[model samples]
Every structure is written in C-alpha cells, then in structure tokens.
Target chain A: MTDDKDHYIRALFDISPAYDDAPVFQQKVMMGLTLKSWLRQGLVVISGLIGGLYALTQFVRMPEWSLKGGGLYTGSLQMATRRTDATVEAGVEFIDIMARGLADSLFAVGGYVQWMQTPQFFWVSFALCSCILVLYLLNDAQERI
Target chain B: MPQSPGHNSAQDQSDIDLIGRAVTGSHTAFGELVRRHSGALRTHLRRMGAQSSDADDIAQETFMAAFERLSEFRFEGPFIAWLKMIASRRYLKKLKAAQKYLFTDDATLFETPDEAPPPDMRLHDLDSALLQLKPIERVCVTLNFSAGLSHVDVAAETGLPLGTVKSHIKRGLDQLKSALTVPNSSSHPIASSQNGAAGSATPTFMDERR
Candidate 1:
C-alpha cells in the first residue's frame, strides 16, 4: 500500500495534461474576444458601421471622384467654393456641401436623422453613431428600470 | 492558433507588447494577443479545476470578455493577472452554478487525466494531496510547486496577505500529511484511484505512518 501510494503521488508530479486538445480548442473559441467594456454594444455596432463607411470613402472613393465628380457629382447638393482660386472649388464645395447637407438632414430626419445624412458621409456616420447611442440609452434605462 | 507568431518563446516581450496594443483597440494587435494567451489560459483553466468539456467554453468567454472590455484594464503589472482573473471568474462562476464548494476538497469537480492510474489519485500524488487540502491551500501549493510562483506571487494571485499565504501553506501541508499518512482502505474513494483521491482517511484516523 505504501509503495502504491508513493507511485501514485509520483505519477501526479510527472502528469501531462489530461486534455491535450483543450487549450487549442478553447483559444479558438476565444479568438478576437475582448473581456467587456463600458461601451454600449449597439453603439459599437453603429459606430463601427459609420467608421467603416468613412474609411471606405477615403480609401475607395476620394482618389477616384473628388475631381470631375466634385461635390455636385451627385447633382442634388450645391456647395460654395471656400477659396478665391477655382482650382479646388469642387473639393472645398464637397466639404461645405456635406457639412450643410448633414446638418439639414439631422433636422429633417429628427430622431431618424442618423439614417439620412445629406452631407459628407462623415456626419452621416456621426449622426448614425448618435442614433445608436440614443437607442442604447433607452435600452439601458429599460434594463435599469 | 496554438500560440502567437512572436510568442513561440520567439520573443515573449514582443508578444506581450502586441497584446498590450490589442488591449488598446488595435484589431491586429488583438488578433496577435488572442493567439498568444489563449493556449496558456486554457491550460491554466484545466489545471485550475475546470472539467475538460467546459474548459474550452470557459476560456472563450474569458477572452471575449477581456477583448470587449479591454479599455477598463489598467496594466499595472504583467497582463497575465488580468487574463488569469478572467479565467478564474469564468471557472468560479461555473463552479458556483453547479453548487460545488470552491473552498472545500471537492474531487468530483475535477476530471481525472487518463494518463494516470486510479480514479481517486491525481496524476501526481503530491498535487492530488494538495488538492485535497482547502482551496487557498491548494492554490499556494500549485503556485509554489507547479507554476514555481513565489509566496509573494501566491499572495498576489490569491489576494491573501503575504504572511497569511505562508501560514496557509504550512497548515495545508500538515493537514495533507494527516490525510495521506492514513492507511489506504481499498474501498475508499481515493483508494479507488479514480479522480486522483478524495481528501479523507480512515482507521484510528490518527494512527498513521510514512
């Protein structure tokens, strides 16, 4: 019995893992996970969408269109040139028009303004984020209540 | 992945740094971070007493929670503590849900590794003996023996006062000896050698020897 006990104890010290595959399997499940955050989940989604759009615009669209297409490329929005030189009128017009359009859209859309921005996609994104935050707050309040 | 690109012990510092960046909301940084700590955390979870079946799920939950709420983390020391905390909570919550007592000697909760013989005996009798002790005691012994963590590290990990950790270790050793020295009755659960030994003994319950 003494020898048996000793052998058992010794085996434990040299013990290999019981489940060799467990760590790998678990980690796969954990991929891309963050612990938790104060950031609202819905807000993250909305912000992510807005930011993604902004990036897509910068990388995918700016180089291609801001030239002949300019701010009026879409045709409905009109924007004033910021500089005396006409060389970059369209670029300046693009920024100004986007700003004004998004502002007006916010008022026109009211609560849903986030979904319908008239200006540059950036403010549309900002408004969308705001909408998400508001909705998150409502749900959060309901949870608390 | 099994581990991270850089952390194959290729460069622990670089991997840790990348993980820090991930915690800061860098998507690629987080990807590297996940690849780095996930394996060790899973292994640690299994060692910490999670069942093999649940270990993966628990590990996943821990990482996800860590990634999503990383901004709240303040890396005052090594980030392992944070990861450990996440894994610990996930495992502890499961234990709580099962109504298993974390502080007590509960062998039933830990599954037996097949490499070892006997249902009650742990793969290593020593670790098994340590497990038979109380939770804090088990933690001290594990850190000291398995992880090679110092008493100070144990205190840090367990939130016990430094001196208290030492005392727990001392007292835990004594009780473990008391438990182990008793003559093995074949019918006993530990004697059955299934999960590596439960934490009790028999006979005079006092008359024992090496």
Candidate 2:
C-alpha cells in the first residue's frame, strides 16, 4: 500500500459503464411470441367465421341463367340458353365447371399458404412454451434449494 | 434420522448449515455468498479479458448458476475457488462471443496509440498488465493474482493440470513485470524510469475474507 498517487484505477472507474446485450431484447421476444400466437389463433377463428358466412350463401343461390326478352324468367339446369348477353349465353356450356374449379383453386392456395406458415407458427409457440418451462424450472429449482 | 434445525447428521455441518439456511429462503445468507465472492469473480473476468461491461452480467450469471447448482456445491475447500472456476469458464464463453463480435475489453481491442493504458503505474498494475498478456497468460494471471486462488484452484478453473498453472503463473508474472517497466510513452509519466519502483509482487488476492 505504498502511496505515489495518480493511479488509473480511480479514472478507470469513472469511464462510463457499458452492457454486453441490449436490455430489452428478452422483453421484445416475449411480446413478439404473444402477437404471433394471437395471429395463429385468429386464422382458426376467421376460418370458422368464414365457414358460417359460406353456409348463409347457400340460402341465396345464384341464377343459372336469366331471360331478358320476356323480362326476368328465373332459370334451371334444363332451361335453354336464352340470356341477352352473347358472352353469358356462350359461357352456359362451362359455367358450372368454371365456378367449381375457381372455388377449388382459391381454397387450395389458401390451405397451402397456411401449411407453409405452420413451422413459423410452431416456433413461436415453442418459444412461448420454453419461457413457461424456464419459469417452471426456476420454481422447481428454488423448491429444492 | 430426526435432528434439530441447528443440528444434522449430514456430513460437514458447516456446508449443510450454510446451504440449509440458504435453502430455507435465507436472503442474508445468500447475500453473504455474493459479497464474499463477487470480487474474485470480477477478477476472473478481467483475466478472461472481458470488458468490464460484461463483468457484472457474468458475475450475476455466475451466482445464479451457482445457486441453481447449490445442491452440488461440495464445499470441500474455499468457496471462492469453486466460484472462480465457474466464472472463469463462463468468461471464456463470453470471450469467444466477444471475439466473434469484434468487441473485447482487453487492451488488444484498441488500435495504435489510443491502445496505450494510462501512464500512472502506482496502483496494482497487475490487472491492467493482464491486458498485455497472451490469452493463456491472462487466464493464469487471473487465477493466481486476481482470484487469489491456490495453484490447484487455478488448475481446476482452467481445466489444466496443477503443474501447468504453477509454470504459467511463474513465467507470466515475469513477462508482466518486464512489460510494465518498458517506457511505451515519452509523454507517459512514471517518475521518468528512476522513480519507478519494482512492483512489490502482490500475493495474488488481497481479499482473503471471501
């Protein structure tokens, strides 16, 4: 403990403190996982909602065809193609097939995209689960302590 | 076998008493562990060449890990020795990460003239001289001087054999003494060489109460 004065340790202590990792990174990850969980839940909720809306659509069926000359005669499958528009008349041959095909295509695309997102959904879910596990482990370790 | 709160059949009552008290949610006892051990831990990190910024986090993690594994603290010798080993290993991990990030507390992190340490050499140059040492030399210097750990403790912390720790400490200190004496800065003050006294050879740790 010889005193000569002017040591840097005193100054070293004065130079500002720096932290290695950002303080909020953990909190940000926690919130992101929560938002992702809700979005995934929203997908399932929206599917049920849209399914209910589709059931209501059945009550208001689309006309197979319309006759304009006689002024709005409702149509059926066996009715002759007597629509006013040439395009509508021409499309009569493939109307049912085209409508069914388009609906199928839309559903298929939506399902594929959802399936692709499953891994991301699962990872967010796993992160949340791990946080729970860590919380539990901390409790369990404390109990033993 | 039934025993009173103060008495137990378990081996080494001293360890059991401290651990049992800590286990029973004794805050003061745990605080005892922290106050007793944090200094040596900080020293261990310094040897690992970690930025002081990382030291407290590493120190906190060290205690957290120790408490997590409190059931396993054998308490065979000095608890400081045990803590030093854990902190040293953790510091190595942090060092690897720091290297990857191109950010380290070591004097090596700076480039050129700015890299020079403060001119005054009166205080324990032991810790700062550590910045000049090779990685292995730094670790060795940490275990002996900073941690005040025995050679065995140094070996245990580094996972090197006891003989290796002894040799590194002996050689490392010699090199450190020589390096500190060199006049790196003409502007740097050290009483202009003649006034500079030989470092009285600190006997590793100054904090023995731990």
Candidate 3:
C-alpha cells in the first residue's frame, strides 16, 4: 500500500494536459496579438497626422522674403516689417491668396485647435477614423475565418 | 509577401533576441515565444486548480498582456519566470473576481480533510486525485513536485507566507500519500518524468533542478 501510494503520487506529477490542435492554438494567439494593437496604432497615426499638419501650417506662414529667395531668413533684417521691396510684397500677397484658397480645405480652420473644432473638419476626421476602424475589423474578421 | 529582408526563422533566435524583435513589431517572434510557452503555462494553471477552459483562457490573456507590455521587460531576468509572474497575477485576479461565489472562506479553504482510499485499491494515475486537494495546496505541490522548485522559491513565486507554504506542502504530501493506494512492492517511474512535457512550457528555468 505504501509503494502503491508513492507510485500514485509519482504518476500524478507526470500527467500532462492533452491539448488538441496546438498549431491552431498558436495561430489563434498570433491572430490575437496582431489584431489587439489597432487602437494604439490608430492613435499614433492620428497624432502623427496632427503634428504633420502643424508643421505644414508653419511652413506656409514663412515670410515673403524667405519664399522669394527659396530659403528661411531668420536675421533681424528679414523682420524689418518695411514694405519696400515690390517682389517681397507680391510674395506676401501670393501667400494671402494661397491661405484664402486653403480656407475651405483641411487646414484652413485657423490651425489645428480651431480646425479640430469645426463640424466639417470633425466629419472628415470621423470619416477617416471610421474607415480605419472598418479596415481593422475586416482584417480581424479575415483572420478569424 | 516577400520575406523580410533580414528576418530569420524564430527557432534559431534566443529568447532575448526574440523579445527584441517582438518589441520592434515582429509578430512572428512573439508567436514563437507563445508557441514555446503556452503548453507549460496551461499545465501550470491546471495544476493550480483551474478548469481546462479557464486555464486556456488565462493562458491566452497572459500572452496578450505580455505582448502589450513587452517593451517594459528589461531582459535581465529569466523570461519564463517573468511569464510565470504575469500568469500568477492573472490567476490571482481571476480568483479575486470569482471569490464571492467560488469560495465561501478563502482563508480556511485548505482546512478540509483528505479522503481515504480503500485498502485494496490500486492507483494508476493521479489526475482525479489532484482535484481533491485545495487550490493553494495543489499549486504548492505542483510547483514543488512537478516544476522542481524549492519551497523558498515557491513561496517567492506565489507570494505566500514561508510557514504557510511549508505547511501546505507538508499537508498536501500527507493527503496524497493516504489517497494513493498503489502496490507497495512494485517499482514505479519517478515523478520528474513529466518534466519533459513541462519543459515545453518553461524554458531555461526548468533545466536548473533544485
């Protein structure tokens, strides 16, 4: 009886759980890891887009002198504020025209904060987000099948 | 799709290398880690008293949580131990959530007496016998007997009091001895034989026998 008890205890230690279709389980785990990051990935993309738009707005607001010379001029002379050069004034007028044309485009709602508040901009963002969400769900569903 | 230019088979990579790749968004590397560990993790959970489906669910959740926070892994410790820690946390959380219905008094759960086996009974396996012990006792015995962890290590791993851990192990062994009625003269296989199967679940850590 003592040996029998010992053997039983020993056998107990050796029992292994039998899982069916291990590779299938592995594939399922991989599918989950792949699909789980959608929310984080989407947030990263959205934030990156916002940062890019801000940089673009800054680039477009460059002084007329800088645009005429095709380079940024940060010297005090560039900040003189005098409307002496006709070419610089023309460059400034060209920028105003461009900004007005873009008034109805994506970035024209007075930079990121103001643009983010408009219903039209909201709908565009909402549409973009919806598309991303749909695509993410589609990929997840494909993996499931 | 074309093969990733520099990507190699995950089988050849060390765990640290796999973890590095996983942190950089290589899902295949992470998948390999999961394939390597899931079996042992499931076994561990089962031995800890989880039902088969619950064990599988917890294993899945453990891997998902580990992948989400892979960057936080410092690579200084054994990866399996880290995984075990995560699994332990998830198990504790599950226990806490189910405490209201599953256990009437969590502290005194292990106070039940061991059922006696008939004098002439010949035990062939321990599967159903294991389910007879309390959850904590089962966990302590499995970690100590199957995984070859020392009592100190088991205490550290499970975060149970040292005395309590010792008591659980002693009581568990006694109960198992009484419940198992195998023939006294028959030579039998050692308990550590299942170490091979458990090896798949735990990697480097299992090789270091206490």
Q: What is the TM-score of each candidate against the true structure?
A: 0.41, 0.40, 0.56
Off by over 4 Å in 2: A1-145, B1-17, B97-119, B144-170, B179-210
The best candidate in terms of DockQ: 3
* Residue pairs in candidate 2 whose N, alpha carbon or C atoms collide under 3 angstroms: B145-B204
For model 2, residues A57-142, the per-residue Cα lDDT tens digits are: 43443343222222132244216666546777667747745655665565554444454345675577568769967997996664
DockQ of 1: 0.08
Instruction: Report lDDT (CA) for all predictions.
Output: 0.52, 0.52, 0.64
Report the poorest 10 consecutive residues by lDDT, candidate 1 chain B. B201-210
For chain B alone, what TM-score does every candidate structure achieve against the true structure?
0.51, 0.57, 0.65
Alpha carbon deviation, residue A145, candidate 3 (Å): 32
Which prediction has more favorable TM-score, 1 or 3? 3
Candidate 1 lDDT, tens digit per residue, A1-145?
A: 7555433433333232333343365446444343233345666898689767655545432223222223333333332344346657766677766876775554443423332333655576678769978997996553220
Where in model 1 is the C-alpha error above 4 Å? A1-27, A30-145, B1-13, B103-210
Better of 2 and 3 by TM-score: 3
Clashes of each: 35, 1, 3
Q: TM-score, chain A, per candidate?
A: 0.27, 0.28, 0.33
Worst 10 residues of 2 chain B by lDDT: B190-199
Higher-ranked by lDDT: 1 or 2: 1
Instruction: Give the higher-lDDT candidate: 1 or 3.
Output: 3
| Residue pairs in clash, model 3 | A4-B182, A4-B183, B40-B201
